[model samples]
Target chain A: MSHISLFEFTQVVKKTLEKNLDPTYWVVAEIGELRIHPKGHCYLELIEKQGEKIVARMKATIWSYTFQNLNVWFEKITGTSLKSGMKILVNGEIQFHESYGLSLNIRDIDANYTLGEREKIKREVIMRLEKEGLIRMNKSLELPLVPQRIAVISSAHSAGYEDFSNQLANSAYQFHISLFAAEMQGKDGTKSVVEALKNIFKEIDLFDLVVILRGGGAQSDLDCFDTYLMGKAIARFPIPVVTGIGHERDETVADLVARTRLKTPTAVAEFLLNGMRSYEESLLRSYERMIGHTQHRLLNESNRINHAATGIKSLSHQLIRDVDSLLRIQQQHIFDTIQHLQKQNDTQIDHLTGRLSLGLKSNLVRSQQQIYGYEQFFHFSDPEYTLQRGFTYTTIDGKSLNKQEAPTIGQVLETMTLDSTIKSKIEEVK
Target chain B: MAKELSYKDALEELEAIAHQIENDEPDIDELSALVKKAKELIQLCKKKLKKTGSEIDDAMKELED
Candidate 1:
C-alpha cells in the first residue's frame, strides 16, 4: 500500500489541485524573471507587491503555441508591448506539477481586464499621492520661458522621432533637442527606455522637458509604455514628462504618469509651439493696452488744459468790456452837467441887461429862452424827481432793496442819496 | 449614471473622442463636440486616477504593516 506508482502520484497531485482551486479565476500580478525555453516554451515568475512586501507569488508557463497566440492577441487588442514588470491579468487553468511543484499553466489572457486593473491601481496611487501632498510636491519643476532643450526618447528611425525633430527644427523657434534612441516595443524596449531616461536625468541640466515619443507604431509596440516599471519611473521622476506614444484608443502607464500625454509626437510638438504662441500673444495684448491707456490719459490732460485756457480768455474779455461801458456812462453825465451850468450863467447875465436898458430888451428875451432851456436841464438833474419815481441811491454797502428803506440782514449797512446823507439806523428791531 | 465607467473604459472613450477630433476633415463643429466630449472624458479620467491612486497607497501602507 505504501509503494505507490509514479503515475498514480502524479495523478493525485493533478487531482488535488483541480479539486482545491476554482476552475475559472483571476490573478493580478507583475511579470517578472521571464524566460523562454529553447523548446518553444515560455516560463515566467509572476509577483505582486503590497508596498515593499511580496504579497503574492506564482510560477507560470505557456506553451510555444499558446504563448505566441496570446502575445499576438494581447498586442492586437491593447496595442501594448508586454514585458517584465508589466501588470497583467491571467485567466488560465491551474495545474500542479509533481516534479516542479505547483505552477500555473496559463491558457488565456485578457488585455482589457489587466488594463482595468492597472487603472484601478493607478487611481489608488494618485490618491495616496494626494493624501501625502506628494501630488503637488513634485510640481515645482519650472517651465522654461522658452522650452528649447528637449530630451527625446524613441527609436532612431521611428516616425515619431522624425516628426518631433523635424517639427521643432522647422518651427519659428529653433529648439536645441537631443535624441536618445531606444527600442519602443517588446520586453527589451522597457529596459532600454528606462536606461535612456536615467542617463537623461543625469544630464538633466541640459534639457527643459523630457519627451517620450513613439510614432505610428502598431498597438503591439505600446506595451512598453504600459509597463509598471515605466509608470513608476515616470511617477517619481525629477523632470516633467510629455508622452506621445501615438495610439488613438489606448493609453499606456507612461501616459498616466506623465505631466502631459498627447496623442502623437506631432501633437506634442504642436502643443509646445502653441504654448509659445499664446505667450507671445499675451505679451502683445498687454503692450497694446498699455499704449492705449497712456495715450488716453495724455489726450484727456490736453483737453483739460485747452478748456481752462478758453475759460480764462472769455473772463478777461468780459471784464474789459464792462470797464469801458462804465467809463462812457460817466463821461456823458459830466458833459450834461456842464451844459446846464452854461445855460444858468446866460440867463442871469440876460436878466441884468434887461434891468439896465430898453435896448437890451431883445437880448433879455433871448436870455429868457435860454433860461427856459436851463429849466428843462434842471428838471433832468432834479434828484427829488429821480428819488420819487421809485429810483433810489445808496452809499457804501447799502443799496436799493425791494422796499424803499428795507435793509438786508447780515450785510454791512450804509446809505446815501444823490445830494446829502440822511444818516439813520434800523430804529426798531423788527 | 452609466455605472460610472471604470478608468480604463473612460480612457478608451476619451481616446476615441480624441481620434475623431484629430481625423475628421477639419470640421469645426464636429471637432468642437468631440473636444467637449474629450474634456468630459478627461474629468472621468482624473476621477478614476485619483481613486486608483488611493488604492495603491492603501496597498502600500498595508504592505508596510
Candidate 2:
C-alpha cells in the first residue's frame, strides 16, 4: 500500500520489458477477441490456452497503416478474415501505459501460419470423423432418384436460399422444399445449423436430403463450418447433406464431410435439376426406341401379308380359267351326243320302212301265183269246157238216161253244148 | 325284164304273168316260157331280199358302235 502513482508504476514496467524482451520478437497466440477501432486500428485480446481455460492473456494492437496492408495480405493469402479463435504468429514489442495497462504493439503477422493452423484444425476434425466411421456414413446413403423433398438450412432472408428455390422453380420440376432457418455465420452459426439438422431429422421420412446454404461472404465467416461438431453432424446424418457455402478458395470441414459439396447454392440447385433432367431424357430415348421397333415389325408384317394375298389371287384366277375351259368342253360333248342320236333315229326309220315294203311285195306275189294254178285246174274239170272239146251228153225229160229203165218212145231227148243250153223233158233214166 | 328290178316291180311282173296264162289262153310253149321268166324273177327277188337284210344287219351293228 506504500506505492507511487499508477503512471510511475506503468513507466517502470514498460522500460523493464523494453530492455529485457527482444524487440520485434515473434510470438504465438490465439485471438480470443478482435475488433476494429473508429480510428482505423485493429485491437485484439491474445491468449494462450490449455483446453477451455486461458492460462495467459495480452492486449495487442496493430497500427492503422500496418493493419490496412496486413489485413489485405492476410485475407488475400488465407482466403479468411482476421477473426477470433484464429491462431496467429505475430512479431511485436511489449509496452506498458499508465492509463491503459500492459499491451503488445504488433508490427507484422504471418498469414500462412494462421492459414496453416486453421488447416490443421480442419484436418483434425476430418480425422476424428474418420476414426468414428462417420466420414462416409452420409455419403453411403443412396440419394433418392428424384431428390425432390429438400430441407434447407440457411438464414431466413439470405440470398443463398432464395437463389436455390428460384433455380429449382425455373427448372419446372416440382420440389417439396421446407425451410429450417438458422444463423449461418458468427458465434451461433454452428449451433444453429446443427439445430436445424436435428429438426429435419425429427421428420427424416419427409425429406430426401438436406441443404446447408450461404451466399458468398468473408472467408472467415465460414470458420464455424470447420468445427468438429459441425463436421460430425454432417457426416453422420441419415440423409445426404449438400453444402453450398459460397467461398471461392477455402474448403471447410463441413464441406468435406457432406454428401455433396458445391461452390454456391445456385450450383447445388443446378446439380439436382440436371440429374433429374438426364433421367427423364433417358426415359424418352427408351420410348422412342420402342416405337421405332414396333413400327418396323408392323411394316414387315404388312409386306408379307400383301405378298401372300397376291399369290392367292393369282392361283384363284388360274383355277377359275381351268374350270371354265372344262365346262366348255363338256357342253360341246353334250351337243354332239344330241346330234348323233337324231341321226340314228332317221337311219332306223328308213331301214324299217324298206323292210316292210319288201315283205308286202313278196306276200302279194305268192298269193297271185297260187290263184293262177287254181284257176287252170278248175277250167280243166268244168263240163262246159268239155263240150267245147267236141264231147256231148243227152237227157230225156230233163233226166239222164241212167235214171230210166229204158228210153220210152214218147220221152223227148235234150243235148248240152259248151256255149249253148239244151231244154230236155224227163222221160227215162240213163 | 330288168334283172335289177326292185322287189315291188318283180312281184308285179309275176302277177301279170299269171294273168296272161289264165285270161289270154296261152299255148303251152308260151306258158312254159312265161313260167321260166317268172322263176327267174322270183330268184332275183329272193337274192335281193337276202342282200338287203344282210346290209341292214351291218348298218344296225355300225350304229351301235
Candidate 3:
C-alpha cells in the first residue's frame, strides 16, 4: 500500500499492459453492440456467450483510418460490411487506459467469419421455418388472377421504392399500390418491417399481395431480413408476399419465405405487370372465342332462314301451277257441256221445222182436191154443159118455172130442152 | 343488355350462349336472340379491356392522419 496517487497507479498499469500484451493479437468474438462516432471511429462491445450466458465481454475500437480500410476490405471479400450481432475474428492490441478501462484496439477483421456466421444463421432460420411447415406457406398461396392491388413495404426514401413506383407507374396496366413505409436496414429494421406487415394485414382485403422491396445493398444490410420474425411475418401473412431485397448473391430468408422472389424492385414490378398482362390475354382469348362462335351461329341461322325461304317459294310456285292446271281442266269441262247443250237444242229445232213443212204440204193437197170437186160440180151444172148432155127443162111463158104456184093469169111461157128455148106463162093448175 | 353484367360474368354468359348456339339447340328465334346477346357481351368485354380509369386513390398509413 504505497501512498501513491490514482493517476500514478493508472500510469503504471498502462505501462505494464503495453509491455506484456502482444502488439496485435487475433481474437474471435461476436459484435454484441456497435456504434460509429461522428469523427468516424467505430466502438464495439465484443462478447463470447456460452449457451445463454455471456462468458466474456470486452470494449473495442477501430480508428477512422483502420475502420475505413477494413470496412472496404471486408465488404469486398464478403459482399457485406461489418455489423452488430455478427461473429467476427479480429486482429487487435490489448490496451489499458485509466478513464476507459481495458479495451481492444482493432487493426483488422476476418470477413470470412462474419460471412460464415450469416450463412449459419440463415440456414438455421430456414431449417426452423421448414420444420414449422412455413417455408412453403407463402408460395402455396394462390395469387390473384389480376394482382393489381399492392401493399408495398419499403423505405419511402430508398431508391428501391422509387424504382418500384416508377416501374409500376409507367406500366400499361393499372395498379393500385399503397406504400407502407418501413426501415430497410440496421437493428430496428426487423421491427419496422414487422410493423408495416401488421398495418397491411389490418386492411388485408384492400391488397392482392404484399411486396417487400429494397435497393441493392451490402449483404450486411440484409441481416434483419433473415430474422425469425421477418420469416414468420411473410410466411404466415394472409396475403402473399413478394420480395425483391436486391441482393445479387445468397437468397435471404425473406426471399425464401416470399410467394415470389425477384432480383430487383423493377423486376417485382414487371412480375406484377406480367401477371395482369397474362390475365388480359386470357380475357382477350375468351372474347375472341365468343365472337367467333357467335359469328358461326349467326351464319348458320342465316343459312337456315335462307333455306326455309327457298323451300316456301318453290312449294308455293308448285301449288300455283297445280291450281292453274286444275282451273284449266274445269274451264274445258264447262265449255264442253255448253257446246253439247247447244247441239241438242239445234237438233230439236230442225226436227220441229221439218214436221211443220210436211203438215202444210198435206193440208194444201187436201184443199186443192176440195177445190177441184167444187169446180167439177160448177162445170156440170153450167147451161152449156147441160145442153151438151141433152138434159133440158121446160117452161110455158115462164109457167114451167112456177109449177108449184097457182096461175093467177095466163102468162106467156117458153120451154127449152137442151139448147131449145121456150116462153111460158104461169097459169098454173095443181 | 350485357352492360349490367361484370366483365367476368359477361364473358361467362357469352361462352354459355356460344355453346348453346354451337350445339344448334335453339330455334331460329332463340338463336337470333342469343346471337344478339352475345354481341352485346362481346362489346361489353372489349370496353372493359380497353377502358381504363385514371383515378388513383391512396390509403397509405403514412399519408393518413
| Fraction of the reference Cα-Cα interface contacts (below 8 Å) that each candidate reproduces | 0.00, 0.00, 0.00
- Number of clashing pairs, model 2? 17
Order candidates by lDDT, high to low: 2, 3, 1
The lDDT leader among the candidates is 2
Badly placed stretches (over 4 Å) of model 2 are: A1-6, A296-430, B1-65
- Leading candidate by DockQ: 2
> lDDT of model 2 at residue A211?
92
Best by TM-score: 3
Flag regions of model 3 displaced more than 4 Å: A1-26, A97-99, A216-220, A277-293, A319-430, B1-65
Docking class of 1: incorrect
Q: Which scores greater on TM-score, model 1 or model 3?
A: 3
Q: Write the per-residue lDDT of candidate 3 for residues B1-65, one digit (tens) a residue.
A: 53377866775676576667656545433654766666666566555543421111122222222
* Native-referenced Cα lDDT, model 3: 0.79
Cα lDDT computed for each candidate against the true fold:
0.71, 0.81, 0.79
Off by over 4 Å in 1: A1-68, A81-106, A110-113, A120-128, A138-145, A180-207, A221-240, A248-253, A301-430, B1-65
In each prediction, how many residue pairs overlap at the backbone (N, C-alpha, C within less than 3 A)?
17, 17, 24
